[model samples]
Target: MTIVLAAAAAALFGCGTFLLLQRQLTRVLVGLALLSHGANLVIILAAGGRGAPTFVGGDEDRALLDPLPQAFVLTAIVITFGVTSFLLALAYRSWLLTGDDEVQDDVEDRLIVTRWSVSEELIDAEEAALAAHAEDVARREMDEEAHR
Candidate 1:
């Protein structure tokens, strides 16, 4: 059959790209289920093989087979089995909250190493102490409008 379904979709995309470059998390959830069964064996070898068997009324000369790639590999295996059960429940809630499953480290590298140096130096010392208390309340309201 198309060279044994193109060598079983190149050995399921080379063992799902070597278990998605393993670091664990159950070999990246078995390399996303072997790259979703090598993209449903390349959408059933682009839908075509084992032909012969389809007839609509008065056997209008048989030879059918194209049930739209078996209904698009049964709706892409029920949406990749609900996205592999939501990526194994977010890798079991990231191994129960960070006991380790790897991943983190890039929310803009933890917002540039733990929030730009202590919240930008306490927001520039509270905007230079509110601009020196607004220039001492505008020089005491221009010395009470030059003494009345």
Candidate 2:
């Protein structure tokens, strides 16, 4: 049973993440919803081992299901619902504004990527300089502490 639930959760999260990486807004919304479903399943699986309901009054020795996970799942469901609705509203607005449902890559991001060319040697030099600066600061701090 645990294995089955784990597999299902994994499938949901995998599908959700795959969908999320697409360029369409609708797919992203659906992906978020799927992710929420995966989270709910995880919460259920973590809620506790199968046992008697927590409401039972007199089964002192019997294991009872914990209620915290249930509460958390419920709250998460409400939050996810709100987020989905907001995303739908945004999609609707975007359609009104641009008549397109697909999201385009940001112009700034593309431009920056095209313009920047950092060599491996440059990165190594920057790291070495930063490390030396950090070491100098540490040494000065230690000297100050010794004097005090």
Candidate 3:
């Protein structure tokens, strides 16, 4: 049973990692789901296979299944569900924003670079205009002073 659990864990981990490395956002979300399931399984296995439910008034000597792991798994499932929902929403928003499905950090990076270049150009243009205006004003002041 331990060997089987270990194999299962390894398989889940490998698949999850593979999916996460994919460029598609959906694949990454799926990978996270797989990883969560793998973690839940690991926790349960660590507590031993589901044997019997825990009871307050039951026989104390009987090997009761660990309720802690079950509780933990339930909590984890809820948390994972919330995260999955959020990821889906984010994916949809990204699609709306970019009209592309595959995850693309590179596109965003390029856009940032382009925007920065435009901003720099605007700043340079404004500075040059301000300097030119200042020079004109200084020349007029000098002419007025000479006449006085």
Candidate 4:
């Protein structure tokens, strides 16, 4: 039924999105595959259910099925398969180069997590305290020189 297909598509899409968020390259690849499948299912459902061939036939009572969607889904499937294979190969290469399939955080992400966690006000206060200490030390050095 259409309802069942819709539910299946939604579930696949949700699962795929969840997997895509993982750090592992393998999981990401799998997620992409699931997402592609969900999209294909939606496309087929949109076209309509299975019926007679789209081409003109002798049977006047038979409903002709639209073939455009089927053709499109087939093409998309082939493309997705090729792309998924390439991505899997890349993930495997990454694992061979390192020991794990998990992707490392980029500099930008690390900076956002670490550098932005410190408050600007706190940093300013710390800098001011250090400057005051430096000035006091310099003043003492000058005083000792004057006494000598």
Which is superior by lDDT, 2 or 4? 4
How accurate locally is residue 77 in candidate 1, as Cα lDDT from 0 to 100? 87
What lDDT score belongs to each candidate, Candidate 1 first? 0.75, 0.83, 0.80, 0.84
What shift in Å separates residue 53 of candidate 1 from its native position after superposition? 12
Error in Å for residue 76 of model 1? 5.4
Q: Looking at candidate 3, what is the lDDT of residue 15?
A: 98
Q: What TM-score does structure 4 among the candidates reach?
A: 0.68
Please write out the lDDT profile of model 2 over residues 1-148, one tens digit for every residue. 8778889999999999999998789999999899999999999898766655776752757667888888999999999999899999998988887798789666445444544686666656666766786898899999999999
TM-score of each: 0.40, 0.70, 0.64, 0.68
Best by TM-score: 2
Where does the lowest 10-residue lDDT sum fall in candidate 1? 54-63
TM-score sort, best first: 2, 4, 3, 1
Residue-level lDDT of model 1, residues 8-115, one tens digit each, is 888988898888888767787788788888788888777656555644532556556566876888898899889888877888899897787876555334445655
Tens digits of per-residue lDDT, candidate 3, 7-102, equal 898899889999999988989999999988889889878666545556654376566666787789899999999989999999999899779668
What TM-score does prediction 1 earn? 0.40
Which candidate number maximizes lDDT? 4
Candidate 3 has which clashing residue pairs, if any? none
Candidate 1 regions with alpha-carbon error over 4 angstroms = 42-47, 50-62, 66-69, 83-85, 102-148
Regions of candidate 2 where Cα sits further than 4 Å from its true position? 57-61, 114-148
Task: Tell me how many residue pairs clash in candidate 3.
Answer: 0
21-43, model 4: which lDDT tens digit per residue? Answer: 99999999999999999999999
Q: List the residue pairs that clash in candidate 1.
A: none
What does the lDDT come to for candidate 4? Answer: 0.84
